[model samples]
Target: MQHYRDDFPILGREVYHRPLVYLDNAATTQKPRCVVEAMTAQYYETNANVHRGVHFLSQRATDLHEGAREAVRRFINARSTAEIVFTRGTTESLNLVASSFGEGFLKAGDEVILSTMEHHSNIVPWQLLRERKGIVLKVIPMDDRGVLDLDAYRALFTDRTRLVSCCHVSNVLGTINPVAEMARIAHDAGAYFLVDGAQSVPHFPVDVQALNCDFLVFSGHKIYGPTGIGVLYGKEALLDKMPPYQGGGEMIARVTFERTTYERLPFKFEAGTPDYVGTHGLAAALDYVSAIGMERIAAHEDDLTRHCMERLSCEIEGIRLFGEAPAKTSVVAFNVGHLHPMDLGTLLDRLGIAIRTGHHCAQPLMARCGVEGMARASFALYNTREEVDTFVDALRRVVRMF
Candidate 1:
């Protein structure tokens, strides 16, 4: 792998007179200089409204905007650009699925299967579906190591199961889910599977066709792109069947006093003047990741995760690590004994060691683990082993203080 740190310019800066160690990647990643330059170049030279203007600048803007959609299509290996719809973020993407597809297919007594380790974004959408349509919500249990119980998940699917929505990776636990198997089980049971790829897409290469999921959603910010930009990939036929989530100019084919018709597959879901700058930035982010190679990024992050895990296990005492899955992502969720995660994070911040400390949008997982919250050190390709060592040292000092 190339020197991953070289791509992210912020890695060179010092904080608190110490080299900064940023491990809060699960929340959001720092943008590479390439991504920053792309956005800057767009605003400085080519800035125009997309898809509606007739001038040269408008054509340029439209091409860049649509090119981003194609980039997203290639990023996840979706069937076509028509299957990709832009949204605000993963939260909005999942909500779009729930509001459009969920409302169309789900009915009273229909069951929606979700796992216990899902983030609130995945959980709350199904809850909304249940409340509005009287649909049944079934939760698949997880093992002690934070891995989902495959047997339990399989048993949860039945003829009444309308859809199965689950996370590709648990944000809090770092457990990479068996989404391919889960998709197969859902399909065999005559149900559609939706993979929440907010965590997985950034950490690993994703081929949606290989996974055979009916839908996949991810946020741009988590992938080193701009915030407020996300992609939702749906099967063409499924998107055709689902009703529009919103109504506006871009998504309509013809509007009249008597009747109105919607546009084709993807635009039918995106119903307003979209986030043009954000999409351009997202395209640049994907380009940057592609240049770096996803496999190398994943390998780098895995190395960092293993290093942190080893340091915490062999070097630190009285630290209770959460999420012990054999195959995991870069996140290390844990807490030192008798120390609240917030306090640990505060001290670590003083030392220029950034980490996340909270429920991490996975309250159910925190409850299952019997902890109020955890201190999480999540990695990205831009992070380094030296940063992990610094984080470990800071953690040791925090443990000693209490």
Candidate 2:
């Protein structure tokens, strides 16, 4: 309900002699001042490695670092900090699960079910496991509207299906998947479920327990935090059963030439020096968003999404909008006439409008949609209806030239 236009300093910046209209939020959000200041303050005050030294600075830094872990646990409503493992980003988090979970639970003949709309992060890790461990990967089909074919998805699972992993919201389509039902379907088939919450986390309230997913991953940068930090949430029993993703000094309890033992719970998966400053930034970002409230943010974004869609549809003739699902988030994927997405995007940039154009790292989804690429204008809490007006007008200008 509140307008936070000034919270982000980057919005004041001009591009190509025009006011900046930043709509490429699905790629990465612009950081708030609080997030930037928090990371800066952490380095200036508490700059020491966690769980390593015994001195005052180390103890103080460790507390701040561990406090961040608790903040992330509370952000997603996770059961405990033990279930949250920090990684570089969503990609690394998914890779950790693929490498550790694959080694522990998957065998030669096991199957993993994924959706066609998954980002490359979710797809590549499983493909790597297939190549390394001989695991079979099946894709859940989606319709032209970018909605997943749920009936077909259910049929893809067999007794060999060891895991069912899908995105909570499609980064390209913006279709919010029915993950709770899908999780139940996987459970009925005796399979564990994982949800990629990268696109969903910043915009809405997400409860890992309510979804009944064994694992969930999301990136902090997408949620207005600093880059190179992500959270991986796994059920305690499952994470405890899986092996460590990488072996290093911090993750170890004892080291010997004969044998070495690993640390417990969260630390076991987080090897080497953790990003303490970035963790602080993430916590600050969560606090910033929470102050505004997720429900309010989601509602504002939904209104903006519909407004942008209506303007584009009514003003621009022959504008083909992708992802027309009844239930969707704030992304609008469209290609105007025969104008190539890249050409349209380049011209729009000259007008000081930023929009993502291409396959959006989901080549499979692009192929399924029967397009080489598309121009995506995604909204965030800080984005505005005025910026949306500027974007649509600029898009019209770009289309006229081509």
Candidate 3:
């Protein structure tokens, strides 16, 4: 982890005349030098519109663009590149599914099941679909420990159930839900499963085939790549039957005043000029993590999370930690002795320790936890135990001020 820290140039900078300790990985990760350089090289050498022209620059740019698609396909172990559809980010990806799939398959009375702990990106899409398609939304409940109840999830299914969308890992809490088993249950009840992988992809390996999910969406920025680029992966058969999410230049085969034909597979969903440079950078980020190996990275972050939890529990009096599931990841949410999370977070920022303070886009989960918002510390592979110690010490100092 120490050696990998050098690859990210932003980590060396100081904030407020103090060394910066970044723990807000759930929001977005710091980019590595290779990712930045990869995007820079593509823009400098092969800056051209892709998939339209036969000129040398267009051909080169198109190849790099499609090559990134293949890289994403391999990274998630998808069956083929045909299933990968690029979008702006996870929010757009979820909206794409809600619009296209709802228009194509969901009837007026169809139901989509979601979990209590899901981020708003996953929950709001279906709510929008409900408005348009008259679909009913069902929720799978979780316990105080932030673990979803599998038996209750099983009971949420019915004949009208059309889809089950859930977070692979909670962005607010660190709960790693059992998506594979949830997918199986959804399949048994004749419902398509979609996993929101925005929080999980950067932490552990996600095999689309093994999960057997009909759709999986993640953002590149969360995985150490640039923003404005993300992936929506659907089973080939499902995507083949669904309507195009948006219609425009690249996603069209032929256009007529009366009728227009859409493109096939991924391009059908990708409506505008794709982010070719961002794709290259995302591929480089994926390559960087793959070289380090997901298993090794997961182990390192697991140790860091344990250390963070232990120190925060021991050093800080009147501290309350959230999300204590048996299977959890590298996030800790907490508050201390009637002190507002923003106060603690603001004081920590002054000390040059960065962490997130808010409902974290999971307002429903915040309500369930009996709080308005909580301070969050999310760890990544590049984060170290020394940083964790510093963060804990800073929190202790902030607590004393209150």
Residue lDDT tens for model 1, 28-52: 9999888888989989888998998
| Alpha carbon deviation, residue 279, candidate 3 (Å) | 0.6
Ranking of candidates on lDDT, top first: 3, 2, 1
- Model 1 bad stretches (over 4 Å): none
Candidate 1, residue 211: the lDDT equals 97
Q: 108, model 1: CA deviation in Å?
A: 1.1
The deviation in Å at residue 322 for candidate 1 is: 1.2
Which portions of model 3 miss their true places by more than 4 Å?
none
Query: lDDT for each of the candidates?
Result: 0.91, 0.93, 0.93
Give one clash count per candidate, in the order shown.
0, 0, 0
lDDT for 8 (candidate 3): 93
Question: How good is model 1 by TM-score?
Answer: 0.98
